[model samples]
Target: MTEFQTIHPLGDVPPQSVESGDTSGITLNVRHEISMVQIFARNGREMELAKKLNIEGVPGRASETRSFTAFPLAPGQWMLVSKNAPGSGFGTGIAKKLKGIGYVSEQSDSRVCIRVSGSQARELLARGCRLDLHQSVASKGFCAQTPMAQVGVLLHQVNDGPTYDLYVYSGFARSFWEWLAHTAGQFGYSRGGRGH
Candidate 1:
C-alpha cells in the first residue's frame, strides 16, 4: 500500500510584514499539519459521549480546551484539534476507541488553519469579522463559528496575545488566505509558509 503524505497548504514561505516609523503588526503562519476530528452525538447523547471519551470532553459554546482544543460547532457536535501531534488517522482511531458512543469523522484534509497574532491581530480581524474580539470577552480559549470576510470559519482566540486560529474549508483556503493577507497588509504583516 502507498502511504499518502500530509501537506501544509502553505510551506516555508516566511513572514511578511511592513514597518513604517514604529507602527508595525500582523503575523500569519500556516499551522503545521495536525490531526483533526469532528465528533457529533449519535443519538442526542452528546454529554454522555463526551464524558466517556475523556479528552476535555466537548467544549461549551464559545469555549475551547487549553491543552488539547475541542470547539463546539453546534448542539451535540464538536471539533477536536491536536496541534503538532503526529500524522493523520486520529479520527479513525478515536472512532474505534469510542466504539459507537459518537460519530467521528476525519477532518484532517477537509480544512486548513491559519494562525494570526500580535498587537494588531485584533485590529486586523475587526476589519472583516463582526465578532466582538475584546480581550475581556474573547479571552484565551474563546471560540466561535462566524462568517469572516464572507467566508464561514471556525474562529478561536487562543491566548492573551489575542492570537487567533482561523479554520476554513480547504476549498476556500486560498481565497481566505488572500483576504487575510490583503487585510493585514495595511498594518504591515508577516507570513510563515510552514509549521504554526
Candidate 2:
C-alpha cells in the first residue's frame, strides 16, 4: 500500500527572510494543519449551541477561548478554529459536542491561516485591504470578512502585538502569499517556520 502525505497549501516554499539593514518591520508565519469548523445554530437553538460550546451566547464578533477561536459569519453562524494535530478529527469532536443544536461542517482542508505581525503589519495590510484597521477601530478580538489583494479573507486581530490572522481559501494561498511577500518587501519582512 502506498502511503499518502499531506501537502501544505504553500507547497515546498522555504521560510523567507527578506530583510534590509539590521531589522525587519514585519513578520509572517504560516499556520499549517489547523482545524476549522463552520457551525450554524438550529432554529431557536442559538443559546443552546452557545451553552454547549461554553461561550457567552452566539458571538457577535470574534471570540477566543483556550481551545477554540470563533468568528461570526452571519446571524447564528460562525467559524471555529483550533490548533489540533493533523487528522485529529477536531471537527468531528466539535460536531459531537454540539450534536443536534447546531450544524457542523469541516473546513480544515479548504482554508489556510497566515499570521502577520510586527510594527508594520497594519501598514502592509493597508496597501491592499480596504477595511479600516486603525487601532481605535480594529482592536483586539475584532474580525471582519474583507478582500485583500483581490482575494476574500477572514481577518482576525489576535493581539495588541498588532498581530493578525488572515484566513484565506486553500486554493488561493499561494497567490495571497505572493501578494503579501511583495507588499511586505517595502517594510522588510521575515518569515517564520511553518506551524509556528
Candidate 3:
C-alpha cells in the first residue's frame, strides 16, 4: 500500500482530476522486479477465487463457485501485484488447505500500474488498445490482458462505478501514461477526473 501523492503525467499536459499522478497509484513500490504481484489460481481453490471475484483473473479460474486467492495457476505460472517484500500469505494460506496446488510468484514489482478515468478514458485507451471500453464490453470489475504502446498491459476495468485501473511495467509506464493523457485531452481530463 502507498500514500497517494500528486504527480504529473506529461510535460505539456497540465494536471487533471481524471488522472492521479501518485507513483504509488501507478508504479509499484517494489524495490526489486519490474512491476507488482499478480496471483492466479490454477487449482480448484484459485478457480474459486476467480469466480468469486466476478472479474477475470490473469490465468483465470474454472468457475464462479470455485475460489482461490494468491495461488498459482500452474507450474511456472506467474501473477502480478505490488511486490517489494514477500506476500505468500495470500496464496500460501489457501494452498495449505488445497489438495493440489502449483507455484505462485508475485510480479507486481516487475510491472507498473496506472489509474485512467475521467470522461475521456475510453477515447484515451483507444490510442493504444483495440478493446471496446464501452459498458457492454468493459463491464465493471472486468480484467483484460492486452498490449498498450506495444508493451504488455493489464487493464482492470473496476466496477468502481466509473473508474478504470490501468497497469503496466515501470519502464513502459512513463510513455504509456503520457499517451493516455494526450488522448484524454479531448474529453477534458484532469487529475482523478476532478479538474485542473
Candidate 4:
C-alpha cells in the first residue's frame, strides 16, 4: 500500500528564498489537518451547552479541554478546533456527545488554518487586520471575527508570542495566502511544515 501525505493549501509554493536584506523573523505555515466544527446551541441551551462542553469564562474567548479548543463566535455559536491526530474525531464525537443539545457540523475542510508566529507576527498582521493585537489588550486565547485584506477571517491569539491562527474560507485561501506572503515579506518569514 502506498502511504499518502497531506499537503496544505499553499503546499505547492516554495519557501520564500529572497533575502530582502533582512533576517526572516517569523514562521508562516498552514495547519492542514486541524479538525474544525461549527457548533450551534439548541434554543435556550447556551449556558447548558457551555457547561457541558467545559467552556470556561466568557464569550469572544477560547476555552480548552484535553484535546479541543472552543472559540466563541457569538452568544450561541462557536467554532471548535482540535488537532487532527490519529484517532482524533472531534466533530463526529462532539456531535454524538451533544446529540440533542446542539448542532455540530464538520468544517475540517471548509477552511484553511494558517499559523503565524515570531517577533514580527503582530506587525505583519497589522498591515491587514485592524484589531488591537497588543498582548496587554488581546492577551492569550483572545479571538475575533474580522476582515483581513478584505477577506472575512477568524483571528485567534494562541499565546504570548502572540502567535495567531487565521481561519479563512477555503475559497479565498490562495488569495489570502498571496496577500499574506506579500505583506509578511516586509518583516520576513519562512514557510513551514504541514500542521499538527
RMSD of each: 4.2, 3.6, 8.7, 4.7
The residue-by-residue lDDT of candidate 3 on 79-186, one tens digit each, is: 434333335454453335332543344453445546565444555677778777777656665566688778777676645344566666656766776566555555
Better of 1 and 4 by lDDT: 4
What local distance difference test score does each model get? 0.74, 0.81, 0.48, 0.80
Which regions of candidate 3 are displaced past 4 Å?
Answer: 1-36, 40-100, 190-196
Instruction: Rank candidates by lDDT, best first.
Output: 2, 4, 1, 3
Candidate 3, residue 53: CA error in Å?
9.9
Model 2, span 1-196: residue lDDT tens:
9999777777555544424312677877778768899999999998788777876543336877888889988777889998886479888888889887889988888888888888888898899999889988888988888889989999999987788999999999989998998788888664444532
How many steric overlaps are in each model, in order?
Answer: 11, 0, 43, 0
* lDDT, residue 48, model 2: 80
TM-score of each: 0.82, 0.87, 0.55, 0.85
Q: Which candidate is the best by TM-score?
A: 2
Name the better of 1 and 3 by lDDT.
Answer: 1
Cα lDDT tens digits for candidate 1, 15-37: 44423312566777777657788
**Residue pairs in candidate 2 whose N, alpha carbon or C atoms collide under 3 angstroms:** none
Q: Please name the candidate that would achieve the greatest lDDT relative to the true structure.
A: 2
